[model samples]
Target chain A: MWDYSETVKEHFYNPKNAGAVAEANAVGDVGSISCGDALRLTLKVDADTEIILDAGFQTFGCGSAIASSSALTEMVKGKTLDQALEISNQDIADFLDGLPPEKMHCSVMGREALQAAVADYRGEEWVDDHEEGALVCKCFAIDDVMIRDTIKANNLTTVEEVTNYTKAGGGCSSCHEGIENILAEELAARGETFTPGAVGKKEGFVNLAEKEAAPAKLTGVKRILKIQEILEGLRPALQADGGDVELMDVEGKNIYVKLVGACSGCQMAAMTLGGVQQKMIEELGEFVKVIPESERPVEIAGA
Target chain B: MADIYLDNNATTMCDPEVVAAVQPYFSEQFGNPSSLHNFGNKVGFAIKKARKSIQTILGAEHDSEIIFTSCGSESDSTAILSALKAQPERKEIITTVVEHPAVLTLCEFLETEGYTVHYLKVDNKGRLDLDEYASLLTDQVAVVSVMWANNETGTIFPVEQMAEMADAKGVMFHTDAVQAVGKIPMNLADSKIHMLSLSGHKLHAPKGVGVLYLRRGVRFRPLLRGGHQERGRRAGTENTIGIVGLGKACDLALEHMEYENTEVAKLRDRLQEGILAAVPHSFVTGDPDNRLPNTCNIAFEYIEGEAILLLMNKQGIAASSGSACTSGSLEPSHVMKAMGIPYTAAHGTVRFSLSRYTTPEEIERVIEAVPPIVEQLRKLSPYWGDGGPIENPEEAFAPVYA
Candidate 1:
């Protein structure tokens, strides 16, 4: 069970404004039932004063979601539209004592609704930035822009933290790689380097830890198998470059490969070697050194 | 308010008699079963008696067939691994999509181990296609592990017929009967199922004790290799007190199996009917006619299940949800997903599992408590309007990006 605060429990049980504001001038609805959470915020605001006279919400989610929406309503009341815009999801969570890290998306939903509501009141075109980005998480319908935004705003270095903030990469986690890519890009843009091994911090439901673990510790047959798996995926790309690579032999951390076809004696063979070898090190292990088959002496003949 | 626990499927309250039977073994009778002394001999005899009792409950022809393990997961692992070891040539494993993590996770790991794992999908009602299953039985299939009943929806699988087919094909069959054993009648001696797994806690017994019934004359391999415990099948000293409690619990289950089917089932139906009648956009999940007598899985549209469960928790009512939020799994229950339950309903699925200990008054209390909880959550739901749930619920319930 989630260790919800007493204030959250109180707000969920006795929400200050649980109904829609019928005389509301503007409304904002964010999230949906499919994502396991949704919120609709309706506000009654004075046009001239640009102040929110009253705020009410309808939330479909967990305890924290209801409490977050309820708390959002309470915080926005009597505040000007400009002032309400400043009310961050953190401020709403603060009002409810605090929300669990996993339920932080609930607070983020509240903030989105408030932003949407203010845009609706100003008579401005509400263009969602998320639509511009490619879809990343199909299960939750989360986009790259939303994930990147969450990572930037929170200074999140981990994919799990991004999931907590945006609900991306939470379901099925087929999009974890997508989430990780987005995280890496955002973290890189912020001049922060991502720890590859740390990407697998989230365990249990999905066993991505083994996939994300550094393959540098692998030895012998296991290391060969790992290299073969990575090569299989990279083979097509290599072939598209009028080049192909074969696993000639593996001795210790040194991987000897034979470049075939146009790649065998091409002038750019050194460049290709450097490029493919870099990829191999990144995926397989940092300890791995890729070398041409001709450069290595014949060890154990066929081996 | 008095607490009403209907999440027996997650875990059940230990039977007082079973607890009483185990209390003495914990202190006064505490001895290593492997020790060469009178006290240890007594402990060994107790374990033997427990094994016999479980064997009787399962209707196994021989007591030696029952191998005690730490938990249901271990038993499941042992059986599946044993099958693969026995038939090293066969690279394929057939299982259902809605198996418990014990079986499902293992099968997923097997896929990475260069094994072809075929996950048989279930229909919208959570029933496996027997014809599809029949066609999958080939010479290359090493083992077929299907659960006797689903955990989330309580839908019973046709494991008997599936087992028969697998046996005919020279393939080994294993059933993770963790959720089916105590609630339903079983006669393993009559079935061709090579191995069956059951957890002790599911049948009012204590946790940390489980039984894996491996039929006699079946090719077997041990997952754990150590001291000659569990007839060299599983290693480690027997869980003496836990095993004794399990034995007593099985005795009680055998005595009250009729009551569970009749009285407990009635209460389950009452709870199901009450919600279906009182709550709008609510419907029962899984096959109605073919399910565990003590389980009722209902989905209330327009609202998420974690919210419903939280509100119910405030009222001192306990239940389990298939919602992504409740499980922290990000995806709703696989059983619901396999059944093709839409996002609107799947996120709101709640499971109410009862036991023979459930009373009519507690059922009535739960019935009264649930409707208001649903109403409160619906009031908070954007998809719920004054009339009821919104039209085109699928689209309305989907997450809107901004």
Candidate 2:
């Protein structure tokens, strides 16, 4: 189903360096069977030259994983340990022409295995275990540090892209918020604004265009329900701030809300209303104004 | 050499007879069945015949009970949602965890909409716990939707008995019979299932056509509402070509049912036995004695499924896998996971579904092709060592972070 390149197919069908290097002194293992993909890279390194004389791999995963492992083995041979360490996941993907975005994690596995193997040869402590970083995706055992690093390396802007590259947020998707936070932080570090729903345009999986095109045309009851749902989502945030909002009425693009609890007449009520309006527009994919119940026109207010 | 397709559970090649039967409706009988003219009447009559064919296959009392829809998903959605609407007071639903996404996803959405859903679990053999099913049926339960057979494992559920249980509780019972319809025999007239869904494509008909068999007296609400089509039970113009194709597929299926159980099953057993004999550490992954004759799911320890599938693809063999890699998910199939299959075997699960058209020679090809692929992948698997699959595989392959 994945649109794998012919080169990838070729590498998978006739994997160049499968199995372990017979007289290998350095070895590295990344991923696990439970993760759905694992790779063990064995390298025969020349002690004097610090060069990899031979490289071989055994992978337990998909076609792309096998192909990536084969490609990684071929790419590392005859290269210095430093040079082999320079091969990024993208480089492995490039060697195979390209891997589907969903299978990009396969290349990442290859890169990690290479790094582990190099570290093993150098006798440096390599940590592929989960103890080093804060775990973000409990389902896939992906961590925040790994997510941030992957985002930086791959220029990933969306949670879906991060998942493709790192297998985070791909399981139950409960960690998408964590991944988004990490993405936002990385993007902010790069001086880029994190745009929500941008994944809809890039992946085209969600129909943001349809929602954005006709949010105003949603029928009365449906629009009311949508607004109520959005308000419910915002309720916890408002309540956390010792304030609350109630939907008073919805007329056209105007949303009438009553700021209750500690927010009724606060100095930041205007800012709060502005924030609420912004969230509504983002979530509803429509332009709308949030009006305080006190500001409601006399005629409609009485009615 | 031609490609040998063993992925019938995913989809099937359209039979020649089905294609021929569908051809005329695309051109000569292109008139809308709703129009008031001879052309419309001819198409309408053809649709009636198609409905009757489905009725006969399902052994339903009336042809009107067969409501044609777009696909199996639509039929499933219609039945579940309609049951809820008809019994608005009942806010509970009971279903199995191993249902196709068509049912599972809908039930999940319903959960968010304030409906209490009890997901029944399956055993290691993929068999439902009847005692649990019996206990889950309560007065507040609106519907119990369970699949007749699992798509991944082809493990047939005792739906008739389950339906009888639900029916006694005044609850609607629906079965997604998409996989079970053509391969297994069922007489709905003697059953208590209020609704059943079957996709045309699964039975060798064209896609975009399915049937929702609503028993004569079951209360109903339409999922799609517009034109007074499908006698107001369903909306939109009829899929005439697809309906005719489905009708013919049903006729052909009725004729080949015996062969599917006997000859096709023989090929399936041969393939299963051959692959198991050839490949060590491989085992079947379903209720062996109670599965569809056309389906066999095997798991090769220490190797991943996509690798095996790709290697098989090189040899012009087609199959399906429950591997997380193949599913585009990070976890193996929910079916395998629910069955508590060890990760060592779950990641390597492959499903080979045959049809009545399958031959022993093709089965022989698969048998010969699969062993080497498994052997090849196992050799590449880190868990597979010099002797064979490593002992303590579960501890070696357990979730590292967990």
Candidate 3:
């Protein structure tokens, strides 16, 4: 069983604002039954001041999902459309003390439903469909834009974290590579490195507000030095495993490397290469493709 | 207010008598059965008695057929691996899609190792297609492993007839009878089944002990190779206490088999009928006429299962669900999905498996407790009542699996 907080259990057992809002003018629906969770938020707004007079919700999901939706409803009442829009998925989870990482998608669903409702109130067009960006996870219908946005919002660095936050790559696992690429791009844009398995050690939220204002692009010599530093950091660990790596060349986004010693003909060579690539992308805070020296194209190899 | 446990299909409370039978072995009779001393001789005789009890319950030809293992999963693993090793030429295996994870997971891993596995499908009522089973058997098939009874739906498969069919094809047949062993009667002496597996905890014995009934003349290969235990069929020191507990459980099960079919089944029927009567859009999800006597799986549409379970838990009622949310996965129970149960009902399936210890009063309390819970959750469901948010209700909620 999940280690659910007492507050979550409280909201689950006796949820607040658990019906459609009477005399409601705005309604927003997100998620689908096929996805195993869905939420519909209804709001009664004071037409003049645009204050949410009442907020109610109906959810079809697990205990955490219902609790998240309930907490969202309680948090949004009496707030203006702008103030309500400012409430992130993290705030909803905080209202319930905290949710399991796997159930973080419940809070995301709550946030999406709030956005949909507010957009409905303003008569703005809002599409819950994945048409706005390239679809990444076909199983959950999550798109690349959503995955990137979620990564930025949650400081997600791994495919598993992205799945916990957005339900992408949670099924079939065919789209994990796509999610990883999006995470790399998002991390690059933010000038933040992706650290494999760093989420477990990281605690509390990095002030998301502070993070939003501080991204600076790294380029040219600084970028190359960063890549070399990451490779240098990785050398000791590989050497300990009776394997070693040599930096052969760097061409724009591609970093070519030669595996020496036991690493070259090892059965786990691909996994070792993937780890090297992941570490490079994370440390450099940008997208950098890792190519084995043997797999380098004829033109690149000659150059 | 005592906690009402209706999750017997998952595990059972150890019977007091069985516990008493186990206690003496832990302290007084802690001899190595392999030793030749008088202490070892006494412990070895107790083990013999335990084996005889199991052999009698299964109606096997000899007590030598009973091989004690750690748990049902181990027994299942040993049986399947043994069949493949004994017939190395056959590369294919036939099993049902709705089997316990013990069998299904092993088969999935076997598939990765280049074994051809044919997963037979089940109908909406969770019944197997016999014609499909007969057609799937071929000379290349090593063994056919199907559960005697499904753990999720309590739907019993006709394993005896299926065993005969496999025997005709010169193929081995094994049944994971973990759920069916204590609940139903089985006389393997007249059957062609080469192997059967049963867990101790599923029938009021303590956990950690299980039995694998291997037919007397079957060629076998040991999964664990060390210490010549069970005449070199299995290895490792015996789980003496657990074996004694399981032996007592089987002996008691034989005594209470009639009561299980009559009294426990009546309580089950009362709970099923009461819940269906109290809630609308509710239906049962197994082969009603041909299921285990004490198991009932009901689905309450529109609402999800975890919510209902949480509420029921608040009232000191314990049960299990086939809903995706309850399972750590994103999809509902594979058993429910394979039976073509629609998403509308699949996400809300609840299983209540009773034991011989259940009372009519407890059944009445559950019957009273469930309706209000379902009513409360359905009111919170977006799909409930005149279809609140869905634009095209019929099309949106149409059966996906069917």
Query: Which number leads on DockQ?
Result: 2
- In candidate 1, stretches whose alpha carbon ends up further than 4 angstroms from where it belongs are A127-303, B393-399
**What lDDT score goes with residue B149 in model 2?**
94
Q: Model 2 over residues A1-303: C-alpha lDDT tens digits?
A: 678999999998888988889999998878766668888889999999989999999888889999999999999999999988899989999999987756877898888888788888889877764322456776556776788888899787777567656767655677776777787789999999887683432222133233346544777898899999999998998899899999999998789999998888886676577667767878777777788989888876666
Chain A TM-score (model 2): 0.47
User: What are the per-residue Cα lDDT tens digits for candidate 1 across B1-402?
Assistant: 568889999999999999999998988889898888988989999999999899989999999999999999999999999999988999999999999999999998889689999999988899888889989999999899999988888899989999999999888999999999989999999999899999999999999999899999999999999989988988898899889999999999999999999999999998899879988789999998999999989999878898889888888889999998886555678888888998878999999999987889999888888898888888878788886877765565444572
TM-scores of the candidates are 0.77, 0.77, 0.77
> Model 3: runs farther than 4 Å from truth?
A129-303, B386-402
For every candidate, how close is chain A to the native chain A in TM-score?
A: 0.47, 0.47, 0.48
- Model 3 clash pairs are A193-A282, A194-A282
In the range B101-168, model 2's lDDT, one tens digit per residue, is 99999999899689999999999999999999898888999999999999999999999999998998
DockQ, cand. 1: 0.29
Instruction: Please provide, for model 3 over A1-303, each residue's C-alpha lDDT reduced to its tens digit, 9 standing for 90 to 100.
Output: 678999999999889999899999998887657556778899999999999999999878889999999999999988999999999988999999988756777897888888888888899977654323446776566777788888888777777667656767755678875776677778889898765553432211123223444436777788777777888999999999999998989998788999999899786676577678767755665556687899888865666
> Cα RMSD (Å) between model 3 and the true structure?
11.5
lDDT tens digits, residue span B225-304, model 3:
99899989889999999998999999999999999999999899999999999887899998999999989999988888
Give per-residue lDDT, candidate 1, residue B8.
94
Q: After superposition, how far is residue B214 of candidate 1 from its true place, in Å?
A: 1.3
DockQ list for all candidates: 0.29, 0.29, 0.23
